[model samples]
Target: MKKTLLAVTSLSLLAACSSTQTVEQAQQFAPCTFPDSPTSEAPAWVCDVIPTDLAAGALGYAKKSAAGIGVMRKVAVNDARVQLAAQFQTDVSNMFKQAVESSVNTSTEQGAIENVVETFESVTKNVVSRSLTDSKLIVSQVSPAGGLYVLVGMDKQAYQANINEVVDAASQEQKLWHQFNGEKATEDLTNALNSLKAM
Candidate 1:
């Protein structure tokens, strides 16, 4: 009777531990909510206008002025594009780091993985530029102070598709590297790319 009781107690403890872990994981991806008053430089509506999740592409904000409304809009849109590019770079770098850490196991493989990640980072800028050609202007308003405030959004599907394309191209490059060197030269890269695709 004591053995059965102990066994049930152990199972109950395991169940509780697993449920707590699941809740923590869910909380990590929960949508962010802004306070009644946002203290950031960005407008209060900015969070509502743009997705906080990097997987959902990126948001760019810009405030610009010019002699005419047309010129001001043009310049502000351009500035927003630059901001989006920077955000895209950061997102790609962060995702690459996560993928590499999860996929590569050996310290000896770190150098090769870093090289591939760096290459992917450089290639990501070009991919983002091409992909964001169709990005939409989500918010455009005239600030009370007299300049245009612009916010642009790129859809997550579009961003993922572009990243997939880049990964495929990089995979081809890794294939070539493998041929010139050895299969080991590209194994970490291939694993890392696979991990990214899983994300």
Candidate 2:
């Protein structure tokens, strides 16, 4: 009886240990990316880098491609889920360019651009474009600034990278703009850019 009881206990312990090990070893994965969108289970760096408010807006505008390479393309302007793309996009970009120029010590425009590239998302490759009938650049660069939510899907990595890039840029500057205390130095920096023209 004593032997049987010991055996049962040992079996239970071994089973629990085995399951824990399996779970730990399981290959965790994500999916393909579209334009301004997020992948499943956002990475730690994402939260650490981009502000939630800004990330939400940027992710809403991205889309992932079916063909691999983890490349994401933008959807049409008409099809944009987040309407503020016109305002927020430009604001984020301009801020990033300014910030990079200030900090990174460089000589050529190309070098500076490279620094900007490392710091922010590549807007050229990740844009969803449309020719507006109005003979003007609709949003120019920065989209409107506000709360934006990005719907996430499974098996998307490139899409997630796109979100990470933009969000990272926004929050990166947010930190730089702050001083010792809890002060918002660049308040509503993107607010005016995202607002409607006084017509």
Candidate 3:
């Protein structure tokens, strides 16, 4: 059986870092940097996510769409499965950018607020049952832009929540993304993480 690309706990570390740049520093905010096939394709379960130009009014995505592509690519990427981990970052980054654009466009100053998609992968169920021993959780927040992101990832040692608790922590009622995917037809990060397996 094929494996699920994301473990989730690894993503727990994703935190809401207050803007390092000042309001004046961000004067040169350029979002439309990474440009690719506004139309994208992938596997079946998470495949049909081609975006229908969400770049219309208050929620436009051209600028941030480009930046998201760049940031996600610039992340430190390394995996034995990838012939050259560096190259893989670019390939995977492009795919992720496409997924983001297909799901949510950079139409607003807030960026693609939040996105989550899921696919039934033939992963070892045990993968979700572990935790990174020394991992810690912090942060609790509520925002108008809906900028909550929960990332779960597990390394060989243990499991961990990818996004910081303060940002997208699992609350008393529901898991992060699981709870986020409600009645709305919004972008899904679960689907993006599902395809993280580089090989």
What is the lDDT of every predicted structure here?
Answer: 0.62, 0.36, 0.27
Worst 10 residues of 2 by lDDT: 132-141
TM-score of each: 0.62, 0.23, 0.21
**lDDT sort, best first:** 1, 2, 3
Per-residue alpha-carbon lDDT of candidate 1 for residues 33-149, written as tens digits (9 for 90 to 100): 323223324454444445554333333333444467777777767777777777767777788778767756555455655666677776776666665555566667665455566
Clashes, model 2: 32
Candidate 1 vs candidate 2: the TM-score winner is 1
lDDT, model 2, position 162: 38
**Candidate 3, 33-151: lDDT as tens digits:** 11233133222211212123311111111122234533422221111112122222343344544554455434422322332211111111112123112221111111223222111
Over 4 Å off in model 3, which ranges?
1-83, 105-110, 113-187, 195-199
Give the TM-score comparing model 3 with the true structure, all chains together. 0.21
Model 2 / residue 126 / CA error / Å? 3.0
Query: Of the candidates shown, which would achieve the greatest TM-score relative to the real structure?
Result: 1
Between candidates 1 and 3, the lDDT winner: 1
Clashes of each: 0, 32, 37
Ordering by TM-score: 1, 2, 3
RMSD of 1: 9.4
